[model samples]
Target: MTKGKIKVSSDNIFPIIKKFLYSDHEIFLRELVSNAIDASKKLQSLETMGKFKGEIGDLTIVVELDKDAKTLTIKDRGVGMDEQEVERYINDIALSGAEEFVSKYKDKADTANLIGHFGLGFYSSFMVADNVEIVTKSHKKSAKAVKWTCDGSPNYTLVDNDRKERGTDIILHISDESKEFLEEFRIRELLVKYCKFLPVKIQFGTNEETVKDKDGNPVKDKDDKEKKITTPNIINNTSPAWKKQPSKLKDEDYKSFYRELYPMNFEEPLFQIHLNVDFPFNLTGILYFPKLKNKIEVQKDKIQLYANQVFVTDSVEGIVPEFLTLLHGVLDSPDIPLNISRSYLQSDARVKQISGHIT
Candidate 1:
């Protein structure tokens, strides 16, 4: 194992990553899980493109919390990184596109001042954890597993790991200030909020379901004790409404998806719009009109913005037209830059085009 300092022009990058990008520190869970999904999806894409010849077995992302160890681990059966990739992607933050972003936006005083910018997805883990470790093995047959460890500082250590799996595991040692993330309920809630619509299936814990008897009643033992079975708790929908063809979806399907998007809301939507456009820029999603009881007060931030099925943000003002904030739904596009603030979106040509299309 060799220890080295992360290559960066500015020493302020780590502090900015931990302090600035988001107001809610729990967003670290969303960013880490989202990156795992991206890695898994990239591997699947490679296999589909005839580049990878290995089995894409069980691409489910597993979030395991160990209270005794005071650690949280995110495991994925996706495309893992070798030693060099660990250095290039994790160690060298500047080359990974964070340098330019920090250089431009690091001077911002408050978290509220930043918007639409989320280039610090992986680094967000540092917000909640004092130390983070990554164990990864590439998909190549001859590849060896490697482990990368980093503290909140620029110093990091990389070493060989004996892991036999072809994926990655991110282990985070919870800090004293971020112990809330170790709670099962908090983690579950965050998973439902941010990762419910992710393309990859995420497993957190085990769920219990009552067993049924032959007569369709609850199964009981000789003493009339109810029988139950434990099953894997899969958190996300591998295929969401936006990724499907509009023709293939029915009114009920759209309604069901709306409920999936907003689980707390009970009011049925008055109408819905399925957005699918490719000419100007790739965008697809469903927008719903809730019954406002003829009230002029419209709810904002109800709409969720996604980048290729990964939830980006709820603040869609910069991309969506001002008048359309009345409607609630989802808008997903790959063309939208993932690392810019809301103000940047206004000046961005692609965002302007997307806003025009929405108009």
Candidate 2:
């Protein structure tokens, strides 16, 4: 193994990233998984353009929790990086491989599918992990696997690994303060909240799904009527309603998606509006008008904001008019800028144009 210091502008960078950079440490999960999704999408684009002459096998992102070991692993079947690429991308701290990939293939429609335009999302893992290890093997033929290890400091170790997969596995040593992330239930909730609509499939550890009868009731065995068969649960919706063409969706379809978005709300939406625009900016979503029990029933955070299908935040007041916040729905656009917290949506010229269109 070779040891080197992570190139950074300041020595206090890790502290800042762990404490002040993000509003909540839980954001680390979204950022890291989003990075994995972006990498997977890049490989898919390459395959589509005939650049990668390899099988595009299962691209499901897996989140594995080892409570006894106090470790959490996020694995992806994506475009893994070689040692040199890892040194340049992870160690350099300022360069975004996604940005360069987009610049290189800007003409292709799939290039816009990436979510980590800002280079710093990967470092968010440091907020929750005392140490992080990356095991990766690039997709190029004859490429050898490499492992990169770093504590929450400037020091990092890089060495050859025997991993025989064309992807990456991020193993995080969960910190005591961030032990909540080590729970399978907590991790699953985070995935459902932030990544249900992601283009790539995401699977948390196996869950049992009770088998139902033909009449939509629990199935029973001959000996015991209450007994039912259960199967493994797959957590995410690979293709959500918003990603589908509006013409192809019916009212029931939109309503079904609304339930998927806000499962707790038992009431059906009063009306719905599907927004799809592509000229000045890329935006697509479904806004629901829920029946209000009272004038104050209108909530501020009912609307969720997403960028390239990864949930950013529900607090989008700066990007949209105040009255618009009264409506409950989802808004997805690849053009908007997101800050560190990924909570406060950044307002810019393009975002203003988008807000105006929504208004």
Candidate 3:
């Protein structure tokens, strides 16, 4: 067992993060899930590069909530970490493991899809949790499983864990002030908002589904009602329409995605523009033009901006021209720079190029 203080520049870092790190405390869910996605992508990249020889089992990320225990856990079968890696990445503030991994495997792997850019994202757990625990075991065959725990303070403890899986589990002990997150509905809402279009599958819980017969028809009971079975409630679409190539998608595909984006809006989209560019900056998305009403009331800020498919903001004033804000859909770019919270965009020349291209 080992115990030490986190290597932060200031002792008040936890308080700062809990209070004002992000304008909205709900952003902690996005940050933590994004980190889990990054880990899964990294493991896939390694497999592609012939570095990892193990079987890549189910990589689905699961968000589990225990209301009675006052705990919420984000579990991922991704690239886990050993003790040294945890000390360097989690203990050290602002040192991003994703950034380092990208730099190391830039030429060998599909690193652009990685979502984490700031190391401080993990600490966002403190925003809502009084204590956090990370149980991880590295992909390396010889690595031992370890557990690291922190209590919203600089002090932390690292001890051996009995976890046998090659992945990570982040267990957050919900604080009294932030007990709203422990609710199943609240967590589901956040997952839908931020992770609806993520590349990896996210399972919240299980939902009853009508069992299907061998002929692809719903199985019916003796009462003539459909037979129901429980299945994993996957909240996000692993591959959204925007992520696909224009050549592969039909007109209905665009309209279908629009419906998925705006479920409440009954009207269909008029047309769509598939924006795929890799020259000046990496950007891909689908922008939909909805049928206008006779009232001519312009609705702005329908466009959502994403950094590596992690929803950053819908208010994309600087990334896209004001005129395009009336259009609905998504714009994803790894080139766009973001602040620590990833709640706002930072000024950059690439952003201007993206905006100009949209124009």
RMSD list, candidates in order: 7.8, 4.6, 4.3
Error of 3 at 184 (Å): 0.9
TM-score for every candidate vs. truth?
0.85, 0.90, 0.94
Clash count, one per candidate:
4, 0, 0
- The 10 consecutive residues of candidate 1 with the worst lDDT sum are 108-117
Candidate 2 residue-wise lDDT at 274: 90
lDDT of 2 by residue, 175-264 (tens): 999999988789988988888888888878665555677888876678766664444356778788888899999999988998888889
Per-model CA lDDT versus the true structure:
0.79, 0.86, 0.91
TM-score result, candidate 2: 0.90
Worst 10 residues of 2 by lDDT: 225-234
The order by descending lDDT is 3, 2, 1
Residue 337 of model 3, lDDT score: 84
Sliding window of 10 residues with minimal summed lDDT for model 3: 6-15
**Predicted model with the maximum lDDT:** 3
Better of 1 and 2 by lDDT: 2
| Candidate 3 runs further than 4 Å off | 1-9, 215-226
Report the C-alpha lDDT of model 1 over 129-195, residue by residue, as the tens digit. 9899999998877999999988888888899999999999999999999899889999999998877
lDDT by residue for model 3 over 208-253, one digit each (tens)? 9889988989988999999998899999998999889999999998
Candidate closest to the true structure, highest TM-score: 3
